[model samples]
Target: MNHTTFETPVVSRARTVERLVAGQPTSDGAGVKLTRVLTNTLQRRLDPFLMLDAFGSDNPGDYIAGFPDHPHRGFETITYMIAGRMRHRDSAGHEGLLSNGGVQWMTAGRGVIHSELPEQEEGRMEGFQLWLNLPAKDKMRDPWYRDIPSGEIPEFTRDGVQVRVIAGASHGVPGAVQRDQTEPLYLDLHLEPGARFEQTLDPALNAFVYVYRGGLSIGDTAVPVQRMALLANGGDTQGIVLQAGEQPTRALLIAGRPLNEPIAQYGPFVMNTRDQLMQAVEDFQNGKLA
Candidate 1:
């Protein structure tokens, strides 16, 4: 595991932010067709966390054709379900079901083969899967998995806003999902119209907010859907002020201390050095780690 201390400071004050430029959608030929919305692959707004895929389908035909077994290494894949259910099976002898508001956090350290299939017979399905990179020292470690049930997550109301701590802290609540690095925070925040929500964050951390469901205002700026707003680091202040619009709004706020290391990536693997990346490819090809 990485043992480096975070060099950034806590954010004290942030400006009402502007929106991230529009990004194009790309296709991933997993068993079920997947489209990446606000991902680093398309928009390099967020590093370390590389991609975010929001997949959904109401017809059984769209979801029933699930992802078959595939190999992954050098990174983590976190799946958060908002609706329907999914069945996960991996080569590590791990299998489970993830329902609405549940999470499946898988660390493909050295390597792992896994598949994700829908378990619901009917109704619309919606969820998001995010890809996070592992540092060089921890890349070859043993694979691990965390299955967080919906009820296991912490939820609370501040003023009139509802906050869900999925993988980080918010409003004095921390997430249940554990990470090798302690510098990151992930939150799912929902707010009613005419509400105000404010939370403190480490200024040393790199942060970005993605507007997923509804319109929101950071200070005085309005953020629309499918766009990201980058937050300014606080020099001595404690947090940012969030003001909800007249209508309800939802957004994802993610922050992590920057790795500040060179990145060499090929396909699904990311490494600090090209030599290590080549060895990873060979290991996968020779079936030594797959």
Candidate 2:
């Protein structure tokens, strides 16, 4: 067995972020079948992070149920396409199609109402939706949009494995979408059978790997497909490493600094206080925002 070592800032286990497991419910609407894996209530509070959902439908009937206009606040939503196409239109007057390897990163700082519809492609539609929370100081800030095409992202190859930098830093490369608050690392990796890769990370930040296309063995644990493996951080002297399995493997590695705060959430709105939640509801009802 060949071993590779990666270097990253070290910290004590006491600073490691907590991990929570959630089997997101399958909801049908707007012609799509969505499995909500993580959400505000289940994640406790947003700390440079919040939720993730996977929507997949090979049958037209399952994916045709699209999402209508919905409101969001105090966070950003990132939509990444792995298969099929998605058309997005938002209250900010932003609209576009996210094809395979495309991404839409939108900041719903104050509020925004948007709708996402599956654009049929060879009768299949599959994608991921991730939610990132902003700090209290930037929760009500101005909104912006980053429509990133696949080719525009940075990538590198190692030992027959290719890695794409979706956010943060890796292999001396960094993602384009910059944030003032949360320093996050989002990556898309593809490894050939028998390949291996390792990356360092901040010991104080929470980190995990989600297997979507293949399986991988981390440390002594074998993480299967469609499952997420939460890594142990903080106080550990050695960084993390991964070894690819028999078949080609594709996975997403994500990590971010922690945000320890009380979370008040209601449906599409997430805030720090209950009063803010009520205010968000009122805003949506009054047509002030959303």
Candidate 3:
């Protein structure tokens, strides 16, 4: 892992916690138990970010079947593996094994068929899959994929807090992945007891924090494990202040610039209009989606 110090930004008006959300328990992709944190309903509220699913389980039955072949279009999928092993195969001829602390980023531009299956029989499988939408102009471009290993990610430590820059810039360090359409910022933070951290934000971006382990607080709101705090935007809110409680904590802070464009989605296909979505469905059913 690489380490670098950074000059902390000043937070004149720290953003407050808009609301705390408990993840809805759900099973997906052949009965893989997981929590659907960011659902379809919040798509407009969290524009450019379509969905966020957090999956973790120790039982082989929970994730063994994995995700069979599927099709996706008009978006990108960022799968961050926190533990266990999984293999990815796609119609774009992309293949990779995702282990602990790795990230698999795939752009289903135009469209692509893919499958993700666990390589482990037991142990623990934990990770998150975040769907990021693309602009209309780039939606039908060539497909792309990348498997970022654990060692390739960048991180920094300060005052008992560890920050992983997954996407966008953090402090003075740029993340492993960047996008101009959304300008998404994704960070995994691990904090020791009583630790505090801060980060600056643009007022135009929408953001949220998901606590996966231990507990933390944002502006008097107690965000327990498995909860997400939707950060308030606009006005004088320019940054965020996070304080861990008596126990160590781990969380993902995600923010992104809104596209402010029309959104039409059907199952896995997301497009800018209803006609486009229908076209995607026809393409998939007519054996031409990939």
- Maximum-lDDT candidate: 3
Q: Give the per-residue lDDT digits (tens) of candidate 3, residues 157-224.
A: 99899999999987888899999889999999999999998999998899999999999999889999
Q: In model 3, which residue pairs have backbone atoms overlapping below 3 Å?
A: none
What are the Cα lDDT values of the candidates?
0.74, 0.75, 0.93
Residue-wise C-alpha lDDT for candidate 1, range 1-290, written one tens digit per residue: 11122222234465446446444555453556556755555323455677777777787777776677777888788898989988999988889999998989999988888888888788978878888777767878899998889888877776677777787666556677756573557778888987877777666666777777777888767778766777765466566677778888887777776666666778777777899889888888888664
> After TM-score superposition, what is the CA distance of residue 252 in candidate 1 from its true location, in Å?
1.2
* Candidate 1 lDDT score relative to the true structure: 0.74
Better of 1 and 3 by lDDT: 3
TM-score of 2: 0.89
Per-residue lDDT tens digits of candidate 2, residues 1-290? 11133223332222222343434657745546777766555464336678888877677777775888899998888888988887889898889888888888999989989888877745768778888888888788887787888878777776777888788877566675766557888888899997877776767666777778778877667878877777766575344566789999998888777777766778788899999999989998999884
Highest TM-score scorer? 3
- For the record, the alpha-carbon RMSD of candidate 3 to the native fold, in angstroms, is 0.9
Ten contiguous residues with the weakest lDDT in model 1: 1-10
Which of the two, 1 or 2, has more lDDT?
A: 2
Query: Candidate 3 overall Cα lDDT vs. reference?
Result: 0.93
Deviation in angstroms for 2 in model 1? 31
Which model is ahead, 2 or 3, in terms of lDDT? Answer: 3
